[model samples]
Target: MARITTPLTNTEVKQAKARDKEYNLSDGEGLQLRIKPNGSKLWLLNYSRPYTKKRVNLGFGKYPDISLADARKLRAEARTLLAKNIDPMEHRDSISNHQKEKIENTLLNVAKKWFQVKKSAVTPNYAEDIWRSLELHVFPYIGKRPISEITAPIAIKTIAPIAEKGSLETVKRINQRLNEIMNFAVNTGLIHSNPLTGIKAAFEKPKKQNMPTIKPDELPDFMRALSIASIKIVTRYLIEWQLHTIARPSEAAGAKWSEIDFENNLWNIPADRMKKKTSSFRTVN
Candidate 1:
């Protein structure tokens, strides 16, 4: 090996390589530039691994940007990391892992997984409706794509079709589901931010809220008309109680005789059967 010395110029480095395809240009202070046949040049720092006789390849920056001067500086930093008992490459890998975890926990990924784990939360009749909307409306378009890749444009496009069908209420529900999924993802360190945040207004228009009750005067006529009309006994009682006590239709049907005390004319709704916002109470009618 030809020995290199300090104060070497760029011309000397290039010329010395003309005679021999493989040569190192000593840039003084333990830094050397190695040139290969393909005209590729790399900077190397001469150093021994900590407590070991073996030499290790620190790294090289892009040519020109990492000039001989800058190359030495990087080598010095790498040496510093080594002195602190850290491996530069290992540190880089750790950073990469952290970034990957952030992406995995993004709202999009969490939304999908939440749907999977909470399928039982929704009724069997409505479960498929929810799944189809997510699969065709959301997943096919953005599923398998990284959570970090979701953007406002993508979100708007994905939801526009559903909104056009006058399913604004459904879209609202979907948005809430996405929000919850993203929250779980955030807790798990899968995503740092939720794209679903502030997404309700993104829908083209606000959803139409269904009227929960009729005018007070309309109740008497409604009850009179239903009592005279021929409807299923269960249906008649359900509509009457729903109107009288403002109970949800689903809850009225799931109510058991055991839970109702006819002697007291009172009904008690348990927490398990109540809707999202309904109060669990012992109602006296």
Candidate 2:
């Protein structure tokens, strides 16, 4: 059992010397408190390993910031860990790693990683758009900073300037993308909090742009013009499918013969081929 020493007083703490100077406590445990002229106090615990008998310095409290009570608590904890046959340094490192993992799961980092993984899955043009919004508008100010460091105020600083420029639609689209990315980050353990949640006026609902359509009266001229322009049969058929079935351009161009049933004149596009959500195949006659 360790014996108690006289209580450490402030003047005694001040008179403590550094390097060559030492303020030795009565317990004779070689527990030294070194005080610099600047009044900064630091503790060093000297002890030997059980089997090796090698001397080692266990670092402890620093100055007034680490009160005597706190230092005692820390020492007690260290002793407990040592009793359990654990190295105090290794235990501290494990705690630090846990804390780092917790912080890494924040919304910002998770979103960035998610974007990196999914970005390649999108078409080149769409990927460019997503990257452009994030890099130009959001990443410059916030990318390298830790996600926990990004408060709602900081997030607003990253986005509000773009929102102010009458680009509500653009802002809305970016916000929605940001929302999905952040949500995914949460699901995958990247972020604990979604900064987008508390932001007001951070987004406006996007107005649906009516798709372009060609009237039936214009069809003959259009087909004739396309034929005169020497469009290939495949290209012509692809365009016709886009017009009739309201399929996206990529979907029409990328359709395979294997997906078409000639007997029923029905084309079945599998869910994987869809540019939109949902996985069920789409059919067109």
Candidate 3:
């Protein structure tokens, strides 16, 4: 049979004095005011572990300071957790640990973690370029800031100077990398949401530009200029080959003698080195 406890009043709690031996004043359902012999009154909850049913005391606060009402409220919350089969102490500790992690996980630290995972998917040179972009444009400003506190306004302000310099391409890449880091923080539980989701809209869009190429009518002048240019013989031949084949700079430079068929007189640019990853061939006429 369960024994009913009478609710304690403010007067009764205030009047409680230390006794020769420690004793508890029960208000109701597991909330108790423990009076020690040395005259300290503490409020705590008498609870049982959900599975093991082992009784444990969870302290709310000292009496009067915590008040009888506050103790009862805390006991109710703890009881709610117990009903859910969750230990209140463990829940409190989990929250405390998460807060500590947020404090320690700075933008630079989280970016580094994201990089470790990202670098595996990209080439070493390309990976270096990605990290270098952040170092030059981002780390100097908010690297030490906690990742959880970064917002779109803060990000725009940080990169506004670069945008002002008319380096729209660089700014665009910075915004992308910053959002990637923020999203990484979210996925890793360092932050609740991404604050830079739509940050790109804050800046002017980059203008559409086309790759400059030499026209057929300009070929004679280009050839004359290239012939007299202060460059090495190999560089001269390389430039001529680049223009003759009409291949992309990467495709031209990455060409090999082995890729050329003497009998066929065809320059075969393999799929790997060619843009769009498609093999291209040009007649050596």
Relative to the true structure, how large is the alpha-carbon lDDT of every model? 0.68, 0.67, 0.87
lDDT of 3 by residue, 1-285 (tens): 978789998998999998999999999888889999998999988889889899999888897789888888899899999999999988888998878876789899999999999877654445778999999989999998888778888899999999999999888989998888888888877788998999999898899889788898998999999999999998898888877887766667667889998899999887656445577889886
Q: Order the candidates by lDDT, highest first.
A: 3, 1, 2
> Candidate 2: worst 10 consecutive residues by lDDT?
21-30
Better of 2 and 3 by lDDT: 3
Please name the candidate that would achieve the greatest TM-score relative to the true structure.
Answer: 3
Clashes of each: 2, 5, 0
In angstroms, give how far residue 238 of model 1 lies from its true place: 1.7
Per-residue lDDT value at 79 in model 2? 71
In model 1, residue pairs whose N, Cα or C atoms come closer than 3 Å (at least 3 residues apart or on different chains), thus clashing, are 105-190, 105-191
> Which regions of candidate 3 are displaced past 4 Å?
1-53, 56-88, 103-105, 112-128, 184-190, 231-238, 250-285
Please report, as a residue range, the 10-residue window in candidate 1 with the lowest summed lDDT: 11-20
RMSD of each: 9.6, 9.4, 7.6
lDDT of 2 by residue, 1-285 (tens): 976677666566655665545444422343567665555677766666555667776778686677666666677777777677677766777888878875665545656677787765765446667878877777777776665555667777767777778677777666677667766766765568677775646545556798777798998998888777776788877777787776777667777889887887677776555655344345565
* lDDT (tens digit, per residue) of candidate 1 on 162-205: 88898887778767766776666666566677777888888755
